[model samples]
Target: MIDLHLIGIGTGNPDHLTGEARRAITQADLILVPHKPGKSDLADLRTRIIAEVCDDALIALFDMPVRDDTLPYLTRVDAWHDEIARIWAATMAAHPEAQKIALLVWGDPSLYDSTLRIAARLDPAPRLHVVAGITSIQALTAAHAIPLNTLNAPVTISTGRRLRDHGWPDGCETLVVMLDADCTFQSLDGDGFDIWWGAYLGMPEQILEAGRLSDASVRIIARRAEARAAHGWIMDTYLLRRRA
Candidate 1:
């Protein structure tokens, strides 16, 4: 039986790893790092994180399966996840002696990540353990030096696709957007809102911009594009709130 640990490594920062994350990494028999095409930096970061906390660690570097965009969104994601599960099982089979396996997730697994869901698909399901880490939202807020919410007001976390399709969620003046490749803020009127945006948070390549949404959108778009070109990939998030 495999004891699978879903460890959150935090938003691309080795120092963001908690003591529990370190313990999990050190105890793991094998750690899996999936490298996507044109995104080698992502896999390299995971490898570096493992090396930082564990000596002579057993790591499996595998190519990530590409999602079929031609299929509908939900179906595409479901099938893609299934393919990942198959790969994980095969990888484990190759390392029969490794009963304690770990996956280094980006940010907290409970927040907008699919590692847990994919893990669940393993045959004869393995025992699961979770190690929480700092999230991108926290990184963004800390980078901007702003409170997540004003007073007792609530904050809503959403994806860029949702924000673009549905506009702002009802009853939420403060919205944090993730997984947006295109700057969807341009779709918003942005009259009374302020935006705090950060890219590659907690890393040396980190960039932060905060101002009225109307004024900041242009700068954000330009900078985000330039950074993406420079690094070949970017993970960013933004918090938008109506100015009180």
Candidate 2:
């Protein structure tokens, strides 16, 4: 039986690794790193973290499969995850002696990450352990120097697709959006709404923008496009507040 540790590394920053996460990495017998063809920066960051923290731990790199866009969303994701599980099984098989294996996840594994689900598919399913790390929401809020919720008020957390489809949620004045590549905030009415937007939080390449939704919308769209073009990828999150 394998002892699998899913450790959160936080958003592309080695400094964000918690002491618990560091200890787990150093103690791991084998660490698996995923590589995407065009996203070398992501894999590089993980490699650097291991190099800095772990001593003489065995490292295995696996190619991550791209999800098919033609299939229905949920179906595509499920199939992609199954493929990843197969790859992971093969990797683990190669290291017959390794009992403790670790995977470094971006941000928090529990928040908007599917590593846990994928891990469940392993045959004889390894004993699972989770080490929590800083989430993008915390990084975004901290970058803007703003509190997540107003006094005694509720806050709603959602995805870009949900926001675009459902508009703003009811019963909450504050909303935090994630996994939105499309800038779904554009779908909401700008009246009385303020936005705090951040990209690459906790990293040297971080960027921040905030103002009335009406005033910032266009600028944010342009900036996001430019940044994505320059970096070949972008991960961002934003908080929106409706003024009372």
Candidate 3:
């Protein structure tokens, strides 16, 4: 059985990598890197991170499988995940002597990431160890220098799709949204909340905006658009607190 290490490398900044993450990389016999057609930069970022910890690391790069857009979202994602697991299994099978294979996950794998889910599809599931790294929420809160919740109130985390489909979560005063490519907040009657949004949270080109949603929505929408156009892609998260 192979030993699989899913190491979270944090948002965009390499500094967000924890000591455990570094050690996991250094000890990994093979590191799997994914390459997407338009996202060469992401692959490069992972390569750079691996280089920092293990200059001589054995890195195997694989082209990422594209999800079928024609199929329903959930079904498409499921099939796509199956393809990825197959590729990962095939890749590891090639370097059978490697024994310990590591994949650098962005942010904590336990969060909204699908690495853990994909891993479950592997045949004879490998011994999995998760190395936690800074999450976008943590980075967003840190960049804004604000507490995540108000006065011990509970915090709710959801995706942009959920927020857009279901409206605000019931009984949630503070909400954090992730994986939202569209400015779904624009669809909300945002007058009663304050938003703290950040893109590229720990990176040098990071952008942050915070204010009452009524005022900041437009600004964030424009800024996010500009950043995405400039960088070709953007990973961001935001926290919204209902104004009391």
The TM-scores of all predictions, comma-separated, are: 0.98, 0.97, 0.98
The true-versus-predicted C-alpha distance at residue 221 of model 1, in Å, is 0.1
The lDDT of model 3 is 0.93
lDDT of each: 0.93, 0.93, 0.93
C-alpha RMSD for every candidate: 0.8, 1.0, 0.8
Which residue pairs of candidate 3 clash? none
Per-residue CA lDDT of candidate 2, range 1-244, in tens?
Answer: 8999999999988899999999999999999999998888988888999999975878999999999999999999999999999999999999999999999999999999999999999998999999999999999998999999999888898899888887888876999999999988888878779999999899899988999999998989999999899888899999999977
- 49 in model 1: Cα distance from truth in Å? 0.9
User: Sorted on TM-score, highest at the top, how do the candidates line up?
Assistant: 1, 3, 2
For model 1, the superposed segments whose C-alpha errors exceed 4 Å read none
